[model samples]
Target: MNRQVERIFSQIDYLSSAPQADRYGLTKLKALRSEMERHRHEKYGLSEVISWAFRIKHALASQDHSDDWREGISWIGDPDASSVDRTLSYEYMRSDQKLVAGSIWNNYYPWIRRNGWSTIGSVHNSGMGAIATWILAVREVTKDSSQIVLLTTRLYFETRQLLQRLLFGTNVQVIECESDCEFLERIKEPTNSKVVAYLDSAEQSDSLSLFQRISSAPLPKPVVLVGWDNTLIPYWKNPVDSHTKLSAPLFLMRSLHKLDQLGLEVASAGLLTAASPAQLTPERARYLELLLSEVKNSMKVIGSTASPTTIRRLEAFRLPNADLAQDSNQAATAASDRFHDSISGVLPKYMEAVSYPHKVFVTIPLPGTNQESISKVMDQIVKQCTLSGLPVMRSPSVGYEFTSISSFLSESDTGDATRFLRVSPGGHDTDMIDEISQCFLSTVSNL
Candidate 1:
């Protein structure tokens, strides 16, 4: 069997074996399995759909844990109260409302037009979907089978894989750059083929600067910039615990407007909804409209001064760590100090930690410690927290596997890692922090 096909089947088997499979609806599972078998021979479309199905299943199964953990930390878990009914709420909304791809674009059109993009020609299922569509669109426009794609540093492993897979069987050249200087220098070279520059939050400012330079350059070939802003949403505030969000619509609007301003075409994607374009019905459109309205209202309540011209600045208001009336710099310093002190109270002696803007990453280094050992330690920590009714998440170390875009962009690498735990202080109080600290300490001491 093809390796990818085998992997897909393995994922289906894994989902089938999940203890909570029935909770996700056996009929849905059966239908997905049937579809998987029917499309086993398909190399492109089915492969992507199956891959996405694995993610959707995992997200659905993990909701209980995620909700409990988020609630313990005083963070918003399920904004829509989807978990109350034991149904995949997002999926239910998509299906029952008949939300499809076209409706998604239609609903987002107002936001897009307000942002200055007159029209978006196509829509895709996810951010990766948009990217794939964009790649093909570029190919069609340039009338060239070969092209060059420039990628910024710190791209996720899965994203890299998707790009490679999508670009396979073509002479497309992908170049990875570690710094702005390198990216700028490379694009300085002239060519008559399509050139796509992909940027993520890892280096947003730098990427934007490079993009501006590219837009202004007197090059012969068409230049387009694709931006991934999936992490821009306020997850800690309205954590509906759903995998999808308004990210696709937001990304589509932002990218299209920005690209149009530069006299270029753009393609973008986001993890906004699991439903495809074909699913958009009238009911689905209404549900999407309501969801987007709630999001905007929530932002307003949080004092987000975002407008169509400055939507990128939309973010949740973070409570100050310290009660100080000093200047901005002094207040910021005091807040950092207070946060570090709070984290120190919870971290185990076996672990050494560092704090970033939004979260803290703690590393536990034991003699001969490897990834497996670290994972065991993480499991123990999680178990203890669960027993004690605390909510915390196991996250990858900074500069390693899956750091947040802000952390990845702002922080420097201290060293490589076996495992690390990330703790966010958002929506958490001092007592809650101490309780979490005790949980970690207790687990480490017992070990």
Candidate 2:
């Protein structure tokens, strides 16, 4: 093993020896150690290295999953094994609860079901999966060519691109609607075609209002609301990096219920999967149990009540720049406010011409720089930040070049093909953000 890997393991051993070591932190450390061991000789690309670094940082920051380290380690040894080896020894365990079934069901499905809306079906996938599943569900519900309208903002370029790819050969007309009035008018227009509207709440701040409007509107067809609830700022509390919990299933279930109440036949999809049929060795089974337990524990820690009503109440108290501190709610809110203020104070210097739609993201367009030049600058900035122990994701532009909503949004249409640099705080505190800002300013000044 290299010195870096050895150093990480040593830190893990030291942290494990602590009187009250964080279980979650230890579990992540162990996992990272395993990953490093597996990929010791392999070379990692820039993206992979950045991803790994983020995972490591997150693992080191969280606690509460130490009990599952042994099981996780065992499963890591044979992840692809088809069945449990009896001779090797394993215990069978099952839960009617689908762990991957997003936070909506796990958190509030019971309440939602009690309200009269029943789940038709669900798919476990990412945001893209949710969109695809909804499209398929629409096709299944209405066995005729339909007009699919996507109500979304520029922030959801990746999602829009994915939707385009999925609906490429279909007869369905996928129209990207940014204006709420335009969407409402489109849905109101009488046609022989069934209209399926896909609304993304993740990218739009006024998503709840849009949802209310759509749910109340007298539309001829059902609206498939895409659950992008992962973008919620308050839920960014989990310290575990690679194990970011998926809550799309829960959102989908709730959305289905809500739309059903409005007399709409709705279907939903999320990033969580139903329980798999594959059997595991006793060790692996134990590991799986621990993993599920960790997720449940995380939900509790994050205060996920699962009920939409409760969630809405919680949303009322959400601070724009909440920190990852879990001890006292008051302290976290204070920290979050400070975090936001800190970034705001430093960002103006380098990001004078930037556009910030939300507190989490800042986008700056390089006036005269081409994509290649901007990319090089961004690579240097990322390397510097990573070296300084603060890694930020560097996206040249928010979305695909051809499918970019920049022109449609009229935000970055500077005549020249603009290359913009996007930055996020990524759970860092004031000092870290200041340091990063300084590094960014220095890099830009030099460039």
Candidate 3:
């Protein structure tokens, strides 16, 4: 598998020079996908697959889409690789919509259906932006004053509160769930309530287990998982749609920024993916259609449609591994693990590091009982690293302390934090990560 990964990057350079570059690239990409599916159960192998996918993405992005597709619709080698850069307007955007919809249904959309992602919604790349608009769409479809909109992450509570009041205080009520139990409990008496959860923190590793519970239980409502974190690891099959129970409709609302395997940040990008036809029962299908319809209505009202450049970028950004493009640094596993071992894993008395998934960060307590304590530790680490002459984080995605890891009720969700100290080594290799880990350990142990 490691050889397969190395081979892709090695051969990737030759792709441009080869007689049939697209053919060569496509062949290798398909092979990589096959290997990914084979080793989907192993996390380490998944990391290799992502690195391979990242190389392919880099190669494709580097290639020049020299021809034009402005007047008429056409793509280079891959039909899904639709690329165009021009000023996009309402009419043009509508045309783009038709083109995108047609392409998805005609090409990869059906194929990706097995991967558990289909019915790509309008692209609204920002995390909060996509959530806000999707809420509006849900609002349009439901008049149930009793209908609950469960927001698992406290990060979105304020936004929902403002929208709740601003939109005439309709039947929809927003509830913030501190834990998965709270999320499930709040919606236990479900009429037509839905949930929107953001798996933004690496520390929150227990959400998938919770989803498994939700999938197995006789719950009626559906949950929409945003932020690219959920799909990073494969569970039963597809992280979102591969639920063995297949009880409720599962819709994935992803902030496209989280999709960058190389951890590249797109300033503006948003994608809301629909449920798989395989999992959608007639009742579930009806629910999905109504919500999707409202989502479109919300997007139309807000004028947050994606730009042509954005469309091009999004098309190029999507890798072929069934949207498993959640933000995971292949380096993060080793670096985060090393940081954890040196700090909380070995020494939990003076300092503690919250356990996280394969994400590229490790956090220590800022030393407060409130979730706020779990935040603002980045500043401390930055100061410590600067004082130690260590390199600052190379990754672009980071969070501020308005709400911290302590906000999560489940200790398993957030390892250990009165507050937290997040130290991430984005692309650093073994030697580099060892150095970075030592630097973090010294700074945190001293604190």
Candidate 4:
């Protein structure tokens, strides 16, 4: 085996020494070791390597089917599978919760019922935020018929450890698959419910089989493919790499585009992607602020006037705002109430009016109101959209406004009016509203 392969196998072997500490370690080692044994002679062959990886993955999976791991460490702290199964029965109440809550619980309770069959693929190593969001989304969407199955694969053991501890009642199926084919098969099973696959990686070619498998399968429910790497999709074929099989990136782009054509809007983190819905860390918020900065710059040239700069500054410089952090549940509740108020008050009039090509950024006026109140409102809205399989992402937050029309025009349009709105929310001519409406109508008429 090559030095890199050897190193990988060695690490896996070391982890196997403490099986309880590294439930996935044996699976990882089996794959690597099997690859080494098979490809010891081939100058150019990784098929054996791939098969070995699959073997180790299968071995680890077998362990999950039994109570052997209970003697080691509980990935999630509910004791046995029965404990997890029993909790779901009581947690998913149908008639009492809100729409978003019902939708989220419906997504997760199925996996919980099936002894946790969800297999989640995280492209980035630091994707705890997204994972956390999934947990919250699942908890809120459970139903009597909910039989959720969820799973995850990560490169870091530490991340898995942290996740097991922080996420309450997460008993999803998890296995380590080092190859693309394995990932495809895990998601290719038959089900009449929602099935999701998260494919985020820079090497799209490696996952070509994944896209093919997904495409071939006759799915009964919605399947979401989460993409993160911008470079994975190759727009045009290059003569040099043409011999390579169809790339995962290109395949995914094509697949998603096709799905979009079929009337399915792919969901993304949207404005609330900073950290998962459950935990928004300062470090993570700052990292997203940087990404949002770039997104804002891209918008300035062609897209809408989504002020990524202002949102980034707000999230980065001022997070866990003291006023907002007093009680997490309460903050979320208040935010929801205020958000409905804002949307009900705005959408009717706002929809009737013309708008510049900018995203709607609502900011709650801050006096006694905490920043979390506004953030929470936006968060709820974004999560709601995500659950319904809609795209509500890469949005920005503008400051508060006296009126919805002004907020819409101010964020999107450029001209004397833009400056006027920003500098004088009150002093602008009252006729500006009429002018704004006419301008918006004229633009839409052309479209």
Whose lDDT is greatest here?
3
Identify the runs in model 2 with alpha carbons over 4 angstroms from their true place. Answer: 1-11, 14-125, 136-143, 146-155, 184-192, 201-208, 212-358, 367-372, 386-418, 445-447
Cα RMSD, each candidate:
18.9, 15.6, 8.8, 28.1
Off by over 4 Å in 3: 1-96, 99-112, 115-118, 144-168, 185-205, 221-237, 240-243, 266-268, 276-284, 314-331, 345-351, 358-360, 367-391, 394-421, 442-447
lDDT of each: 0.36, 0.36, 0.46, 0.28
Score candidate 1 by TM-score against the native: 0.42
Question: Candidate 4: deviation at residue 326, Å?
Answer: 44
Q: Better model by lDDT, 1 or 2?
A: 2
Residue-level lDDT of model 4, residues 23-60, one tens digit each, is 43323332433445555433211233333433333333
Q: What CA RMSD would candidate 1 show?
A: 18.9
Per-model clash counts, in order, read: 12, 12, 9, 27
What's the TM-score of each model vs. the native? 0.42, 0.49, 0.61, 0.23
Q: Which stretches of candidate 4 lie over 4 Å from their true place?
A: 1-128, 143-146, 151-163, 166-168, 175-178, 191-194, 200-447
lDDT, residue 255, model 3? 51
Better of 2 and 4 by lDDT: 2
> Any idea how many clashes model 4 has?
27
